[model samples]
Every structure is written in C-alpha cells, then in structure tokens.
Target: GIQVEQSPPDLILQEGANSTLRCNFSDSVNNLQWFHQNPWGQLINLFYIPSGTKQNGRLSATTVATERYSLLYISSSQTTDSGVYFCAVGGATGTYKYIFGTGTRLKVLA
Candidate 1:
C-alpha cells in the first residue's frame, strides 16, 4: 500500500499570482497523475507525470519517483484555477486504482 500527503491544505492567490503545490508519497509509484477538482466536484486530469516535467498553459507538473514526490505549479493564477489540486499515485500489484492525497485547495480572487 502507498500513502500520499499534500502540503498547504489551503491557498489564497490573487489574480496573476503564482503558486506551487506539493505531494509526497510513501513508496515507489508506477503511475502518477495530477488532477484539479473543480468547485463542482468534477475531477479534471492535469497530467500523468511519472517522471520529468510537463506544462500546459498556466499549469505545470513535475514528478520525482526516486524522491517519491511530485509538484504542481500554477502561474498567472486565474479565477478558473480556484479548486482543489490532487495528486494520485498507483503502484504495481494494486487494483490500478489511484490513491489520492488530501489535496491543496486554491482560491484565486479576481
């Protein structure tokens, strides 16, 4: 079994600000995914960063399996970025189900 933890349970960002969210895992993971759970509770997949870094628009993610941690970077924060960011990890021998971290909730004030 794997354990996940997220830092900064809550965040407040003014429009145009930047922030970094972190996730730490207890064990090695074969799969790592970043998700943004909108205010409506819909989960939007941000990235599947098993390794390296990736960016899409104002959002980016990086995962270091050897260190057992991942990071989500949000730049130029907007009202749309207001939501809960979650990091999910899947390991071998498991059901392939993702184990999510507590999440970092962001509030972007317009």
Candidate 2:
C-alpha cells in the first residue's frame, strides 16, 4: 500500500501568478496520475506520468520515482484553474487500487 500526501493543502493566487504543487508517496508505485477537479465537480485528467516530466499548455508535471514524489507546475494561472488537484498512485500489484493524495485546493483570483 502507498500513502500519498500533497503539500500546501490550500492555496490562493492572483491571476497570472505561478505556483507549484507537490505530491509525496510512501512506497513504490507503478502507476501515477494527476487530476484536476473543476469547480463544476468534473475530474479532468492532467497527466499520467509515472516517472518523467510532461507538459500540457500552461501546466506541467514531473515525477521522480526514486524520490517517491511528484510536482505539478502552473504558470500564468487563471481563474479557470481554481480547483482541487489530486495525485493518485497505484502499486505494482496490479490491484487497480490507487491511493489518492489529500489534494491541493487552489483558488485563483481574477
């Protein structure tokens, strides 16, 4: 079993500001995914990087399996970015059981 935790439990930012969110896991995992829960409660898949860096638009993510941690970077954030970001990790057992991080709640002011 892997324990996942996210840093900066909460965040408030002005529009166009940049920020970083972190996710730490306690054990080794073969699957890792990042998701953004929009204000409307829809979950948007942001990344599926288990061990490398990836970028999509103004957002990017990096995962270092050796360090058991991952990072999400937001550049020039917008109000539309306000939401709860989650990191989910699944062990190598192929159990389809993924442990989700506590999540980082972000609010971008316009």
Candidate 3:
C-alpha cells in the first residue's frame, strides 16, 4: 500500500500573495492529480501531472519521484482560490487505485 502526506494542513494568504503546497508519497507512482475542493464541496481538478512540471495561469505543480514528493504553487492568489487542495496518487504496486491525502486548506483574505 502507498501512503500520501500533505503539508501545511492550514494556510492563510492575503489576496495577491503566493504560496506553495506540498505532497509526499511513500512509493513510486504512475498517476497523480491535484484537486481543489471549494467551500461548496465541489472537487475541481487542477492538474494531472504524473512526473513533471505544469502550470495553469496562476497555478503550477511539480513532481519529483526520486524524492517522492510533489509541490503545488499558487502565484498572485485570489479569493476564489480559497479552498482545500488535495493530492491523489496511483501506482502499479499498490491497489492500482488513487489515494488522496488529507489536503491543505487555504483561505485567501480579500
């Protein structure tokens, strides 16, 4: 079985600030995804980066398998970005299912 851990269980950022969220995995993974759960309880997919770097507007992510960790970067944060960020991983050796971490709750003050 694989294990996932997320850092900074809670985060508070002012609008226009920047922040980085981290996720660590216990084993190698073949699939990974970043999601944002809004206050309304909707899970929105942010990225599906398995082993590289990717950026979407004000958001970006990087995964280093050798270090067994991943990072999510948010630049010029906005009120809309206030939510919970989650990291999910899936590997060949495990149950072949994605396991989601506890998540990093972010609150952006306007």
**Which pairs in model 1 have colliding backbones?**
none
Task: Give the lDDT ranking, best first.
Answer: 2, 3, 1
**lDDT tens per residue, model 2, 1-110:** 68899999999999999999999999888999999999999999999999999999999999999999999999999999999999999997667798899899999999
* True-structure RMSD for candidate 1: 1.1
Off by over 4 Å in 1: 93-95
In candidate 3, how many Å is residue 94 off? 6.2
Candidate 3 weakest lDDT stretch, 10 residues: 90-99
* Candidate 1 lDDT by residue in tens digits, 20-104: 9999999888899999999999999999998899999999999988999999999999999999999999985556777999999
Per-residue CA lDDT of candidate 3, range 3-109, in tens?
99999999999999999999999999989999999999999999998888999999999999888999999999999999999999998575668999999999999
What's each prediction's TM-score?
0.95, 0.97, 0.97
| Clash counts for all predictions | 0, 0, 0
Task: For model 3, state the Cα shift of residue 92 in Å.
Answer: 2.6
Off by more than 4 A, model 2: none
For candidate 3, the per-residue lDDT at 100 reads 97
TM-score of 3: 0.97
